[model samples]
Target: MSTESPSITGPLHDLTVIDLTQMLAGPYCTMTLADLGADVIKVEPPAGDLTRHMGPHREGDSPEALGGYFQSVNRNKRSVVLDLKTAAGRTALLRLAATADVLVENFSVGVMDRLGLSYETLSAVNPALVYGCVRGFGDPRTGGSPYADWPAFDITAQAMGGLVAITGPGPGRPLKTGPGIGDIFPAALCAVGILAAVHEARRSGRGQFVEVAMYDAVLSLCERIVYQHSYTGAVPQPQGNTHPLLCPFGLFPTKDGLLALAAPSDRHWREFCALIGRPELGHDERYATNTGRVAHADAVRDVVTRWLSSRTTADALAVLGGRVPCGPVNDAAAIFADPHVRERGMLSEVEQPGSPAPVVIAGQPIKLSRTPSAVRHRAPLLDEHRDEILSASSAAGDPRHNTSQGQVQ
Candidate 1:
C-alpha cells in the first residue's frame, strides 16, 4: 500500500505551522495540524527528535526508528534541522517564524525568552503570528506558580493536579491513568487554542500568545473532584474504573468477556432490572433509587454480576441496547476489528520505508465536510526536509534559513 496522502483537504490547507516542539505533547499538537492540512514544518535541533532513537528499533533502521511512538504523531509533517544553540540558527528560526502563520513549542517556560523568541520578540517581526506553547505548568503570567520553570511530564501533572487522588480502585491504590493522557490531551487542547488564535489573527491581523499547561489541563480533567472538595470539603477517593456515586457504572465480566455498564438514573436502573429479568431489584428498598443504589453499590454489583455470569457479552449488549447504556470492553485488537470502528474510518494505513507491511494509525478525529483533513505523508526522516525547506526558504531571500546543520536525513 502506498503511504500516499489521503484525499481529504481541510480548511487550514494554506496555514503554515512551525513546530518547535519535541517529545510527545508538542509533537502531538503539530501532528494534528498536519493532519488538518496545515503546512507544519517540524524544526528539530541538530540531533533530531529525541524520540526517534528512544525505543524499539527495526533492523538496519537501528537508532533512527524515531520509535513507533514518534511515528504515531509525527506523520505528515516536514522536518528541518537547525542548531538553535547558535545565533545564526536563531536568526534562521525567526525568519521562518516571520513566514509562518503559527508556531508551537513545549519547552520549559523561559526557554523561548532565553533564546530571544518570546511572543513579544517574535510578534515584532510577524505581527500576525499565532504562538502556541505547552508548558509543564502554566505561565507565571497566567496565575500559575513561579516554579513554572520546572520540567514535567504526564505522570507528574496527574499527581500534582489531583487526578491521581481520584483515580484507581480504592484508598491507597491511587493509580495514574494508563496512558500519557495528561500530556496528549493537553496537547490536543493547545492545538485547538492555536487554531482558534490563527483564525482570529486572520480577521484582526493581531497575533496572541496561546498556552496550555499539563497541570492546568489535568486540573480541568479533575473538575468534579475539585468542586466536590471545595463545596463539601469531601476528599475524593480512587474509584478505579467505576464512578463513586453511580452503581453498575463499572466493568462487569460476561461469559466471554468484560462489558461496561452504566445505569445512572432511576429510569435506567428500572430498565436495567427489567432487562436482567430481575424486576425484584427495582422494588428492593435498598436499591430502588439512584442514591440508594450508590450507597449499596457492593450489593448492587453483586446482584448485577450474578446475571452477567450467565450471559455472553453479545447477548447482554443486545438486550440492553438503546434502553440501557452498555458496551463490551474491547482490547486494541478488538477495537481495530470492530465493524463500527472500521465503518467510521477510525483506522488508517501508513507505509514505513523498510517495513514489509504498512503500519496502521488511528484516524484524525476532526471531520470537516468542505475541507476535511486526511493523512498525506508518512512520518519524515529526521530533518528529512532539510534540503527542500532550506533551499526554498533560502531562495526566498535570507541565507539564515538555508544553512542546515545536524539534520540526520
Candidate 2:
C-alpha cells in the first residue's frame, strides 16, 4: 500500500462511500463524491476494475500502470480487492457497510442479491446506510420496464432515450454525440440522488434505495423534444446545426473554422445585422420577428452564411464577440489554449505510477468559498489499501457482531 495519505478536504469529508462499480456510469458517480471529499473505498474484484486494462497509457508506463479511463474517474479513492463470490468476501463487505455512510453499485439487476449482499441484507446491519444503484432500465423497486434485464451501454442509452432521434443533419441520418452523455448524465443524476438520500438518512435515521436508470436519465436530458412534440404535434427530426424554432442560432462556417452565433431575439438580431454590414435586414418585416425569421430560415441562413464565409473565425469574433451571442466552435486544442480555462483551474495534474512525470486530468468544476473541492491524489493501485482498511475495521469492532443475526426486514 502507498504511504501517502489523500489530502482531500471538503464539505463531504465526514462521509464514507463504498464503491462497488466498474465501468463509466457508476465509477463516475462515485468519482464526483470522492472529489467532494468523501472517503471513497473502491471495492474491486480480485482481477481489479476492468478499466485498469483500458488504454491510452502514458509513455514508458509499465503494464500495471493505470490507463487514462481509470485515472480520469477513480482518483482520490482507496482500492480494496474483494472476491464477492466467496463467503469471506461477503462478510468483509458487510463489515465495511456497517461503518459506511453510503454504498453504490452498477451491477445488473440481481447480481447483488445473488451474491447475498442486497440492500435489504446490508441495511439489516446498518439501518442508516444509503444504497444507490445505476442500471440500464432500473430495478424492480422502481417502475418495471420491459427492458429491465437487458444490458446497455452509452450508445444504447442514447438511442433509446431519444437523443439519437433528434440528432444529426436530417430525419434519416441520426448520430450519437461525440461524448458519452448517456453514461455521464446518469452518473451525475445518480450522484445527486445519493446525496439526497444521504441527507434524508442523516435527518430521519433511516436510509432508502436510490436508483437512476440510464434510459430515464437520458430521456430527462432530451426533455425539450418531449414538450415540443406534445405541444406542436410534430415528431422532431434532426434539423442539422440549426434549431427548429430559433433562426440564426446554430453553427456557421467562417473562413478558417466554424463558429456558433445566436442572434435570434429581435434586439440581438438588430445588433447582429448592424455589425454584419446589413442593418437593412434588421428592419425587414420578413426577418424582424423570430417567428418571421423561422418562416424564412433558408434566406436568413443564406445571408448569415455569406457574411461569415468571408471572415476568419478570429475576425468574426473580433467584430461580434461580446456584442452578440457568438463564439468560435472550440476544439480540444483550442480549449487547452483558452485563457479562461487556465484562469478557472479546469485542469489538474496527478502523479503517475510508472512514469517520472505527472499526468493532467480535468479539475473539479464546483466551487465553494469555505470548503472547496480538489483532486488531492492519483487513483490508487489495485488493492493498495487492504491492510489499513482491515486494521481500522478490526479496531472498531465488527458492527455485524452487535447486530441481530444480520436478518433483513
Highest lDDT against the true fold, candidate? 2
TM-scores for every predicted model: 0.91, 0.95
lDDT for model 1, please. 0.82
Relative to the true structure, how large is the alpha-carbon lDDT of every model? Answer: 0.82, 0.89
Q: How many backbone clashes does candidate 2 have?
A: 0
Which regions in candidate 1 have their CA more than 4 angstroms from the true location?
1-6, 58-66, 283-288, 395-409
Name the TM-score of candidate 1: 0.91
**Per-residue lDDT over 293-345 for candidate 2, one digit per residue giving the tens place of the 0 to 100 score:** 99999999999999999999999999999999999888888887888877776
Clashes of each: 4, 0
Superposing every Cα of model 2 onto the true structure, what RMSD results?
3.2
